[model samples]
Target: MRNLLLKLSPFFLLLALFYHPVNAQNDSIKILSYNIWNGFDWGKDLDRKNKMTEWLKEVDADVIGFQELNDFTPEKLDAWAKEFGHEYSILLKEDGYPIGITSKQPIQLKTKMLGGLWHGMLHVKTYGIDFIVVHLSPHDWAFRRKEAEIISDYTQKSVLMEENSKLMVLGDFNSQSPFDVNYDAQNTFSLKRKQLSDSLRRAKNGPDAYQNLRFGSIDYSVISKFLSLPLIDVVQKKQADHNKKSFPTLVLGNNLSKSEFEKNQQRIDYILVSPNLENQLIHAEIINQGTPDILSDHYPVQATFKYIPGK
Candidate 1:
């Protein structure tokens, strides 16, 4: 009986070496950030939502941070998340334009700030990483700057608390990145400022709007603050050469002509990570293919990071 058991041990060892639990062999986690265009067009387009679900399943990200979840409740988002294989979800608030986080792993809400921010910030912990999802003010650069300062203060405190913290801050900034030099070279900044001025004049809020636009419409202070936190911009770092335009995608309800859209296109969505996670970053992209291009006015940004055990 002892000899027989010894012979079977080799087969058991072989099986243990060959089998792994699901993604155990893959030491990477994919994080995605997207503003789902007013909650999948205000939750009125079911077909679009279905298509988006399919797309999410295909992406197979470990976690996703969302902005502009205007009409989503926690239950509604949970149901949608299950369809795409996410078992855990959390919403910032039910009223106004809320943000959310959904993950394949369990999510623990750390912070939800709604009083001082424009759209608000939703912070959660999952897979041992901290994610702060934010949507800063869209109409005023100065307001966005203030919001960025608040976020910076919070993030700095978190970083100081732990030397090896794995943290990320990402979402629709609604402001242009200073890293995208094309905006200045192509005069896109001036064009957008002119467009803003025209709209404000039409609304008869020209003076106040002009005062807010004093910084010349294309402000870098918001993004610069995050950079100052020493967080790495994953998309900028990985896809440095590509045209990373993430906004004004071809949507169902927009009147912008092809040329107009091209001129107005900018990369507002982002996925930023702590410097500690920089070496683990394998791939980062602004998703532009297939359903994403037509599903929302803003394209999603994704970053893949290799998991380090016991970090």
Candidate 2:
């Protein structure tokens, strides 16, 4: 009877650890991705920074992924994180522009791959989840696609090894979803019309414009490549209303002086997570209440997720 009891003790201990209340709440977290428009022109954004500070406190995010942080020194970023009450920070600075991550919990910086990538991509582990924050090429779709391939390959390899590790990819992709091609056709066509030179127009939609504008036709599949994996866009998949029309993160045309932008918008920023993490998604939102110029060209995107331990 004593020997049998000893064997059962091990099983019971395992159950106790698995069902502990402490472990239950450790996995739930809130994440935010914001493109602060760190530097569109060569001016300063001191007032904007203050507004951002207020915004950050309002969001109360556990983890934050920031992109287009042009000209932020390590010290400045560190201070910014501290001001927001985050205990950990990782900054990837490149040629004055920097991308970064801040977490209230401890962060284990993983291997930083794809060095020399135009904007940058950051990989880290926090709250028992792996994260890849990226700000891909904003100008070229082809380049963005290649970058996505590299990121996808890395994610796939990670999954191959762990199989069920929670992963989240968040940032400003600067591209559109392939699924929304039909909705974007009108906007693409109009943009193309304005881009044609007089000589080019005489040629009547010449091959150069067509080739250069080919990306528009495809609706920019950069995000699609990443989504092809087991990952799902938290807002897109859960928020059915936003599926039909693209929600513009970055606003363009007019309202610049007054810190506003035209109503026409584009949904380029995103937060994507593994299927398991997707199941835990509570809510996702794009924050765009403040004046555009003072707040940011791109709105901040936030998502709430709860971790599911052991699959």
Candidate 3:
């Protein structure tokens, strides 16, 4: 009878191990999204890189999504990430302006879609959460909208497959959100953008550029798609009334006048999370304080979430 009971105890232990929840304790995680301005101005100016690396370490995000990794190799990114204590890293591609993801935890590459989109999309999973990092088209509104559709379609299917999926879609969107009232009220940015678009068009197609140019200064189509996925814009969710513009920092140099800054100021970077993780968000903010412009053209965005690791 004792021998039989001993064998049954081993089976019971195995069952318990299988049924028990993994890392059930609630933990918190920090995620950062930054464009890094053409890979810290195309990897020139070592001082800037050092400063950026120090800032990254200070922020100590669990996962970071970077855009404009212009000339970085996989090993280069990995080395840079290691300086900030992130051991794992992945780059979408080698050529053009590549995007990359770095994490303290092991990152599982889920998808890498670049053919149809301008900058491309990278889907990676870490710490029991799926993160889709994107840098959409910056040149045209219609092209950006199309890119948004591709991202939304994929995310929609992912959401459908797992109702309680903990996910985040974040990066340099390069488009305005409807929720930002500042953009709606201010015509300075819109006018400037339209003028820039028209100039580019004219350059490409001679004087007949007006025929092909359609600039919706305050376009919502790109951002609205992600919102329709029911993903919460962390900035809006946290600071509903505060106007936080994420671009055109001191990268244009510290000499810009107040009016010039205002004209270029806009929120082009974002960190959007799935509804399932919305309630878990602790805080979100644009990292604009203290020489942010020197590090990159766009300020880095950080969000903290209550997470259950290995879930």
C-alpha RMSD of each candidate structure in angstroms: 4.8, 7.6, 5.3
For model 1 the local lDDT of residue 292 reads 91
Clash count list over all predictions? 0, 3, 0
TM-score of each: 0.87, 0.76, 0.86
Give the Å shift of residue 2 in candidate 3.
Answer: 30
The TM-score obtained by model 3 is 0.86
Q: Report the lDDT tens digits of candidate 2 across residue range 1-311.
A: 99999989999999865442312355567899988775433237676687678768776788899887777766767788888878778887645567889887677888566564667778888877888999887545556777888888877886535866888899988777765555455444334432453336437756443232343344466777877885787877655433322334345445333222232455678898888776688888666555433467677788887645443
Evaluated against the true structure, the overall lDDT of model 1 is 0.81
Distance from true position, residue 142, model 3, in Å?
0.6
Q: For candidate 3, lDDT tens digit of each residue in 155-212?
A: 8886536856788999999888888756646637545656777788878988654421
Q: Lowest-lDDT window of 10 residues in candidate 3?
A: 208-217
Q: Give the higher-TM-score candidate: 2 or 3.
A: 3
Best by TM-score: 1
After superposition, the stretches of candidate 2 with alpha carbons farther than 4 Å from their true spots are 1-27, 39-43, 186-190, 193-212, 215-218, 240-251, 255-264, 290-293, 307-311
Evaluated against the true structure, the overall lDDT of model 3 is: 0.81
For model 1, what is the alpha-carbon lDDT of residue 32? 94
Which segments of model 1 are wrong by more than 4 Å?
Answer: 1-22, 187-190, 198-203, 210-214, 252-254, 309-311
| Alpha carbon deviation, residue 129, candidate 2 (Å) | 0.7
